[model samples]
Target: MSFLPASADAEFDLLCIGNAIVDVLAPVDAGVPEAEGLVPGSMTLIDAQRADALYGRLEPEQQTGGGSAANTAVAASLLGARTAYLGTVAADALGLAYADDLRRAGIFYPTAPLDAERAGGHSTARCMILVTPDGQRTMSTYLGACTAFGPADLDERAVARSRMLYLEGYLFDPPAAQDAFRRAAEIAHDAGRKVALSLSDPFCVGRHRAAFRALAAGHVDILFANEDEILSLYEAADFGQAAAAAARDVELAVLTRGEKGSVVFCRGERTDIAAQPTTLRDSTGAGDAYAAGFLFGLARGLAIAECGRIGAVAASEVISHFGARPEGDLRALAGV
Candidate 1:
């Protein structure tokens, strides 16, 4: 299906789909990961009991809202794009907090909360992030009530009204959620809206490589991945091979190589954009912010190179702060 720009009267520029999770950020020494028997730089899905045990070990420095696609939706809104989010949450305190955070950030989140009584006695989803002084963040997420998300939760009119549908790869963990993604993609495609997908993590890519490949080839117009994730997706020996493989499936493929820079491949052309120079206070939401900026540029009909530059600038801003949320006006940063 061909990608189409949103009409002037469209309700939103972008719509994001993913889990809804609150982030509990804690600054810890480098040894904390080992102490907790965790692998550094990896995102591990934990049970509610494990989440509590991990939370008890680290002193929380701050609490913020974060979910891969939700974070991107917030960033896109901050960058001056009309944005919406679709995800599930229970009628609990954390769920309320998550909705409040999204609303306050100017994101349209219309998903009705699940009834508290029928929520399987679970709270909302949460991610416990341990940040090191060097700006590396390791995450342990408890999916919690978000696991209840499925195709039934999607609003078809809302999906059709947006110019683009942004999906998070993390949602592939559950079979029902995978169906939800496929349904959303079909709706977006039928409406002539573009669809983008992020290969959230290397492990996530490894888990659903075949499905991801087919989806990217048939439905996705823009594909996002990091060095390790793209390599894992193609089972390639190196980034070059992975990038080459990616170019054949999607019209646009954006590969982020932390610190080194990012590569944007469109059609048969490639553009290498440098990472903005900034102090790395935390790397928690860099990719999400980058996607937000890129989507904002695309919504505005900016050239591909400008889109990549805006993405780099947004990523730089997120890494310079302590959380995944934007601290300043990204529109001004991009000189839009």
Candidate 2:
């Protein structure tokens, strides 16, 4: 399973923390999103009842453990990085299955499912992703027990032992989770481990732009964002302005631009990486997969440009299929 050589100094090469959600995917007509009052290609929060109703209305094509950071953890594991995930699920069948899936993928998931009784009767989080013909997915997520994650759920030991700590922005929506991420960042910094963050969505950036900026400038060593998300974060006039702002904020910034490829800004240098060629099927986890490959490459001591190239390859693989994860041999596709 060792696709790439890695340093064994740390217990895990990358430790990811965020929401633990099961993704239920189904293809529907382009009008489905509008019919459900959901904007196309946007993620919206829904309640339990709403989630249940939506699930019942559509025939599911796939159900798998997925969350931005969790996806990155799984993909990174497939690429041979020692990865671990820390997120809250619930004491339910779906929750247990999610945990099992991560373990099966060779990624450690250290948190136990939250007890439903103690978690205010919240069940496992679920996301109903309705994909339109154009391969754009509209997500309706029920936070469920995932929002119960707090400082107590943070795996301090794992954060301190990992070589790098990665955070997902969606989880930062809750005040408790925000505190937990800040605490985790502190722990990683104290241990001399690098902290990376993914600006999960453009909506997320709008919700916490000030906080994200503060963390990027002080806590996070590496930042991941797509073009839209980065532009939103900086409130910049264009891509160039946004990239400059990101370079000034973090030690390294990996910005993905769908068909335009990605750019890596580090130490006042810019490395432009071309997007990998692939027949697109779904773009659901493009950013997550890219983060996985790029972070895995960094953990494996590859050059920055090579890291971006591997990221591009990983992202391409994910989008060339129906599922968020790669169905192909990622190692072979990456040519590692």
Candidate 3:
């Protein structure tokens, strides 16, 4: 059987796989947390009942589409690349909303709806993001139907159809999703395409350090991480050591250090790109946006340094907005 899609013999620009979630964002007064005795800036996973309890207490300001890899896919599509998304959601309103949102962003959606029993009883995955005055976000995620997303949910055809496959680290927390990650990597490599991965969060790296190390050494061609996540993955004392270790393992390693800009390592060559100046309104999608810019540049065969610059610009724009998804056309923003 041929690996390429029947419509085109060439590879798609990018294919992303991860959770399908809807983001419910709200602005809270600074002292509200202290008054309510809630911890700030931590991500807590809650069951449907607990999620409902929390949702009842807060006023939802807006609903935006989100999920780490999904956000990256959307940004990649907006940057004028052909992209596809793989994930799971129920056949409910939120799930339909997620599908519609990705479609509007010009990304191909190939997810199957969950069983009616699951959809009827549980809400789709939702992240309640509390944005504080200092431009930081605290997230509480309700996995809901997302937990049922596993290897069976992956589309083999889509994996073989892309030039690059991108996976998020958050999927590691769910044991059922691990096989899906392995499957995507195998399919992508079999098709002669590259596989990319993001270390989703610092705590996530800490949770699955050994598995991540093994994957980074063998399966991952491109790796995306921030200062904390890199440091956690390598158990390094600081950012410098972690960056050096990552460069040795992956074909290309891009590490972002907020305010200090970003660094890219490729085949023993290192390039540093400074962050573009912008008023920081929110830091939600900065990393995902950076990944989109870098991947877009890579797909276009741009120089490594140029890719880092494009990533920096993308990160800058997202930090200036309250949402993880881009507020404007990134292709025009990058002057592509």
Give the winner by lDDT. Answer: 2
RMSD of 2: 2.6
The lDDT of model 3 is 0.84
Instruction: Give me candidate 2's TM-score against the actual structure.
Output: 0.97
Candidate 3 lDDT, 150-214, residue by residue in tens: 77888888788788899998877878788788888999898888899999888788889999999
C-alpha RMSD for every candidate: 1.7, 2.6, 3.4
Tens-digit lDDT track of model 1 for 162-239: 999999999888899889988999998888788999999998998899999998998888999999999999999989
Assess every candidate by TM-score: 0.97, 0.97, 0.93
Q: Which ranges in model 3 have alpha carbons more than 4 Å from their true place? A: 1-8, 31-39, 117-121
Off by over 4 Å in 1: 1-6, 116-118
Count residue pairs with overlapping backbones in model 1: 0
Q: For candidate 3, give the lDDT of residue 262.
A: 92
Lowest summed-lDDT stretch of 10 residues in model 1? 1-10
Steric clashes per prediction: 0, 0, 0
The global C-alpha lDDT for each of the candidates, from Candidate 1 onward, is 0.89, 0.91, 0.84
